[model samples]
Target: MKIVIISLLAISLHLTNSQITSGIVSDFVRTNLIGYPLIHEPKTWIFDPDVALKRRKQFVDLHGDKGEKLIERLGLGIDGNYEERLAEQRKRDEGHLGGLNAHLP
Candidate 1:
């Protein structure tokens, strides 16, 4: 098929013209792995989360209590005590996990 030929051509060209760079890998990450554009004009996930999240708080809202474990599983941030953070956040939210609203006290 024409699509296959195009892919083969692209791969061949890529191999000849460039070494494996982060941007090239980032392009693949953004395109196929994560399916999210390079937000902030940068940053890409190495593997697919397989879900769409438009806003930061949508993470917990989408996954519920499992959200904390999900962050651990996905390596979403620096290695730290995520469970502790969640517990603290819950106390602040009165045991509810919701989106942030800086305007509210």
Candidate 2:
């Protein structure tokens, strides 16, 4: 009976720890969305844009220019400039997609 209880407690702790770790990861990603958009972060699966945008102001204030540069380096964005660049990239992507489709089996 004692052994069974200890095993259960250990299993519960393992599961709880996993959940906590994932939660922190989610929060981190959520808070950094704008800095890392669809192509940039590519961790949309982990951090949705909504959650990220929700904390945008806080993130900017905390990280400032250094943060902005980090996001840019990560392929994310600082703001309007990123959008413009992304738009241009999308156009280029579409052109490439069109070429690839032409050769598809």
Candidate 3:
């Protein structure tokens, strides 16, 4: 009976710790992505493409391949081809701006 009680107590503590850690990590990620005033205005300061690319590079440098896998698991649409995505976005934006310029003058 004592062994069983000890086991249950350990399991409860482990579960509580896991929950707390998960909550902290979720909050940190949300704060980094959305900024502090998320409840009021939802300002996405770190949501810019350049900022995201920089952060991605830093993450990859710090965590190596595991970082890439983590990013993939996060379902952020970054499938380890950040450069390709950035290039594509740049081309698209330039094309759009070029079209606008053509029509302006």
Candidate 4:
């Protein structure tokens, strides 16, 4: 009986720890991956641009430009030049779509 109780307690603790670890990982991804992109280029997503910008500002205020440095390290482009890159992406997208339009009536 004592052995069974100890095993059950161990199992419970393991499960609890797993839950905490998973929560931390999810929060990390949400903040770093989803939040960062939304903040970096609000034009791409349909969410309120102001909210993204505000969250980005909050992140910067907290993290002190680490996000921008990470983006640069990843070779994604500079932080402040999102508009230029976005415009270039739009032009590239339009160019690809333009060829398809020529095929239609």
CA lDDT of every candidate:
0.60, 0.61, 0.62, 0.63
Candidate 4, superposed: residue stretches over 4 Å from native: 1-16, 36-105
User: What would the per-residue lDDT of candidate 2 be over residues 1-105, giving only the tens digit for each residue?
Assistant: 686557556655676687775665555555654343545654435657698778888877776745854554456456648777867756766846633654566
lDDT of 3 by residue, 4-93 (tens): 557556655676687875665556546864666647674555456687667876788766756655653454355687767656656666
The candidate maximizing TM-score is: 1
Candidate 3 weakest ten by summed lDDT: 68-77
Query: Per lDDT, what order, best first?
Result: 4, 3, 2, 1
In the predicted model 4, the residue pairs found to clash are none
Q: Where does candidate 2 clash, by residue pair?
A: none
Poorest stretch of ten by lDDT in candidate 4: 68-77
Cα deviation of 51 in candidate 3 (Å)? 23
Better model by lDDT, 1 or 4?
Answer: 4
TM-score of 3: 0.21
Q: Candidate 3 overall Cα lDDT vs. reference?
A: 0.62
lDDT of 4 by residue, 15-95 (tens): 658777566656666785578565776465566758877788788866557675455334446577777776775666684
Candidates' TM-scores?
Answer: 0.21, 0.21, 0.21, 0.20
lDDT measured at residue 88 in model 2 versus the true structure, 0 to 100: 70
Error of 1 at 83 (Å): 1.4
Q: Which ten residues in a row have the lowest lDDT in candidate 1?
A: 48-57
Q: Rate residue 7 of model 1 by lDDT.
A: 66
By TM-score, the candidates rank as: 1, 2, 3, 4
TM-score of 2: 0.21
What does the lDDT read for residue 80 in candidate 2?
48
